[model samples]
Target chain A: MITPSPALPIAVPLVAAAFLAGLRKFLRRWLADLIATATAAANLWLCTALLRASWHSNIVYWFGNWFPRGRMVVGIGFEVDPVGAGLATLACLLTLLGFIYSWRITDSGRDLFQPLMLIFMAAMCGFAMTADLFNLFVFFELMSTAAFALCGLKTHEPAPLQGAFNFAVTNTVGAFLILTGIALVYAVTGALNMAQIGFLLGSRHDLLVIAAAAFLCSGFLIKAAIAPFHFWLPDAHSVAPTPVCVLFSGLMVELGAFAVLRMTSVMFGQSLLQPHSAFRATLLLLGSLTVVWGGLMCFAEHHLKRVLAFSTISHGGAMLLGVAIGTPAAITGWLTYLFAHAMAKAGLFFTAGILLHRLQSMSEPQLFKRGRPLRFTAVLWLLGGIALAALPPFGLSNGEDLIESATHAHAIHLWVTLMFFFTSAMTGAAVFRVGMRVFFGLGDAGPADRAAKIDEAPDGPEEQHHIPARMFLPAALCIALSAAPAYIPGFGRWFFNAAHRFLAQSLYIARIYAQPVHYVLPPAPHSDLGSTLMHGAIAVVCALLLASWAVFHLALPRGFRGATHLEGPMFPLRKLQSGHPGDYVVWCMVGFVLLGGCLFLLP
Target chain B: MNQIVHIFPYLVAGWVFLCGLYGIATSRHLVHTVISLAVVQTSTYVLLLNIGFRTGGAAPVFADISPGITTVDPIVQALMLTDVVVEATVMALLLAMVVKAYEKAGTLSPDDLRLMRG
Candidate 1:
């Protein structure tokens, strides 16, 4: 039997997208969606096959058979390790689910959504698998261009235009930043292949390298929605169609963290693997700040999608923390957390889409007491929240366990534990508060926040009586799968093995050069399940208390409640997210300089 | 003079990048913002081309040159070409958004597009 080529996952969707776009006017809606859905499924199958093939070892596929001549790479390569392939697989799965969810939901554009979604999927798959630095930039631009177009899919709305514009500008700037970093690295190493560059620049710490690291990290952190660089995310999420928001929060933002992990491991692993490297410290500090900032703002938001958007930011911060730790166990935790978060977050967005479809609004106050009949959706929403809270028996709990156990010997263990608890609780509180207020009608309607005033047209026909099975199936499957890893029995052992190989830089270089791959696998790190469960339980209880406090604040005594409201103190922080693209650009510049200076001067 | 020539192009690229960002942050019109973004992208072209430049290098045209002839790095030029295409696409899309925002909101000023302010 002929094995499926690695490039098929990217090429199939792109070719289908072009075919669909060219013949859009002649094709009927069902035919277009059928072709897109089939293409997505085919891509998923191919990626899954690639994942299985790469499970034992990395699959290095050089285009046109131009293998690296000795140490020099002549052709672009797709290095498909299980981690990268798994990410590509997840992208395909989400895109397929997105297509299914949007089958009947009509947008204003004529047959444009499917093509854009296809291109977006292809770009993400390419980004996940490509090993060339310039190739990564090309795929990054392709992804951003597709995302900007998708965000502005609803040009009829003024807010979407503004949102898409900010997204385009900031992300375009980010792409340029990445390009600059790539240029700097190329200037020094004279190669665009990541493995070659890493081989050439081994253990050489210098000014240029520091600057490149800064630009690259900041560029991707912007994409990942870290604080100060995260202004575009909520704006984009607040206006983009529901199905698009699922991809945005589910995998795209997490891909930024994935890129950072990939870049550091392949390019700067030797220097950064130092015990007290300032680079890791800087990343850790930023991760903690992002968790706190994103969590607090998440709880303060009134818009449903924006709430989820901030939750994405908080969870992204947690992933960055895992990557920042840079242990095999930490990497495993990051991969697990990423998978669980993608599913649960997509499920939450799907449930929000359902509410928007039925109720014609995304404002928590507007949706208050109106979601009484969506009991199934309510259950999905709360289950997704529990996943976000890292409750036991969920994949998120396992991910958190692995990360904490990996860092137990470190001096910063307490700090990591606290950030995890705070972010999970805060984000969970935000979602739970919304679910209780909307589904159970436990609280009276509060005044709408400023975010509620933003206009958001529902993606589907409003006032729908019944949720379609297509829409509900994907969300249900997502929530179910988010809990699958915990029950899979040997999932941690298997994943830790894959992640150990992923973090093994020598094995990666060896694979690219077609040298005999001889590397002994380290024993997988063990999770302290007891400590993790205790912490997870506390986080869940804290989330419940916080949600209850926010929902029934009016009935509670003022003396007992203290002098602050959950949403009140967040006013100063919220002002930084002003919708002006100019202000956002200014902040992006500040972030670049600050991050560059830190990375340069720290060590 | 040699030192100045060696570093001149890099300095110019950095200056142009900063200027573009400054224009974006201070621009009054949305059209200007899009143009500023293009200007920012132009710096990458300058940087890439400058990196590939040699003192007496020829254009990277293999059809006419001998096998061992000195030529600029073809890869950076190729990268610059891709960058230009990406810039044009982004600019076109941003310009379209500017037009739509103007049509829907009746204004082009970022200050007036306050519909999404937190």
Candidate 2:
């Protein structure tokens, strides 16, 4: 059997996307969707195959056979290690699930949707696989462009237009920063391939290198929606179509985390891995802030999609925390959490989409009890909330266990745990509040469950029966897969091995420079009942606190003293977002300057 | 003279980039914001070309040029072309969105587009 080229994962969808673009005008709707669906499914299979093929060693495929001549890398290479392959598989799997969920959506530009989606998938694959820094920037732009078009697909709505405009402006600035940083790196080292650059700059602490690190990381930090740079995400996620939101929150941001990790390790890992490094501490501080901010704002958010968006921010925080810790266990926790969040968040959004489709508005107060008697969706929502809270029956708990252990092992125990619990509970309370008000209708000042609004009929028997099978299918698949770390015995072992390879810079450096085929694997990962139980105990405490507010109505929102000023600090930050492209642009500039200063003065 | 020559482009690029950032911060209209974004993009072009510059170097194409004459790096030029294309595409899309948003809301001011809140 002929070995498939490493480029096929990217080439397949790109070729399919070109055909889909041409076919969009001539073909019927279902045929177009069928082609798109089949392509997405095939892409998923290809990604899995690539992962399996590259499981034992990294796969480095040079374009036009431009392998390194002696010491020089003459051409672009797509280097797919186990970690990159794992992330690529994730991007493909989520895109497949998104396409499945979008099967029922037949809007006017439905045809445009399929091609844009295909392009997005291809670019995501390219971004994950490419070893060239400049090529990574190209793929980043392609991915952002496709996503921008998709965000503005519903052109009839003013909100989507505004949201897409803000998203474009902010992300374009980020792309510029990344480009400039890449250029600086090239100027310093005369190489664009990541491993070559790492080898050239190994353990060096040049001022220019520090500036490049700041520039590169700031760009990705915005992309990953780290705090203060996260203003674009809630607007973009809330206004984008449901399936698009799934990719935005689920796959794209996680990919951003992966990018940041990749840049740090490959570019400056030798110099900046110390405990007192400013880079490490800054990441941890920013991550903690994001967790706190996203958690608090989620509870306060009135719009259902907005609530989910804030939850994405909070989860991004947890992932960032794990990344900043930079342990095998922490990274393993991060990857596992990325998986769990993708599923639970997508499922939650899918359930919320059903509500929005049935009821025109996404306002939580307005949607109260409108989803009544939809027992299956309600149950899914409840379980998704539990998993999101890192309570039970999902790999999120396992991920939480890994991250907590990493914190303690690093000896930063007390504050990290407290912050983790605080943030998780805040967002978890927000989700459960939606569960209480919308699904179960338990939190009412009065006993009135009567038909409140006319545009939305009461959730009668007809409504329950009318739920689309396709709509529920994707959510079910996601939820089931999210629970993998819990039920699958070897899930932790698989991640331990992957993380061991992923975190080892010399392994990557050697793969490119020397092509070492043999390697030693990390020890087999097993579950820690002790850590899991500790996490569960922490979650139970959070659940009880949330129960006081959500279930028993104790510490009632209106009854508390100084209730009016509760969001005092948040109000200023909210004002800063401003929904204006201009303000967002200014923030990006400030962020760039701040990043440079911080990196230049790193201890 | 040599130091000034090397430093001039860097200073100009930084100045232009900062001006563009300031324009975005202070602009009232979406058109102005888009224009400012183009200016920011121009700074990148300057930086790229400056990095590729070699004193007295001719254009990289050498089909008809005499032997032993140095040429500026062509790769940076290629990267600049890509940057310009991406900038143009983003500007056109942003302009289109601005037009649509104006049609829908009957205004172009950011202050007026206040439908969403925390």
Candidate 2 wrong stretches, greater than 4 Å = A1-3, A106-108, A445-465, A524-527, A547-572, B65-68
Could you tell me how far off, in angstroms, the CA of residue A165 lies in candidate 2 after the best superposition? 0.8
CA displacement after TM-score superposition, residue A542 of candidate 1 (Å): 0.7
Question: Taking the tens digit of each residue's C-alpha lDDT, what string does model 2 give over B18-93?
Answer: 8887887788888888898888888888888888888899998989899789989788888898888877887898
Residue-level lDDT for A7 in candidate 1? 83
Q: Tell me the docking grade of candidate 2.
A: acceptable
How would you encode candidate 1's per-residue C-alpha lDDT over A122-161 as one tens digit per residue? 9999999998988998899899999999999999889899
Instruction: Score chain A of each prediction against the true chain A by TM-score and list the results.
Output: 0.98, 0.93
Across all candidates, what is each one's fraction of true contacts kept?
0.85, 0.44
Query: What lDDT tens digits, residue by residue, belong to model 2 across residues A1-603?
Result: 344677988889999899989877898878888888889888888888878877777788899989887668888898887788887788788788777777746373567888888889888888988888888999998899898988888777677887888888888888878887887888788888898888898898888788788878888888898776787887787778888888899888788788989888877788666655788787888888889888776665667778788889988987898899888888888888888888888888887766765656566667778778678888888777777877766778788778877766456777677766776677777777778778777755211111111122111223334667888898888878888888877788778777777877777777776566567875754558776767766775675456345444534656662322322324445556577777777777776676677777767
Q: Report how far off residue B71 is in candidate 1 (Å).
A: 1.8
**lDDT score, candidate 1:** 0.88
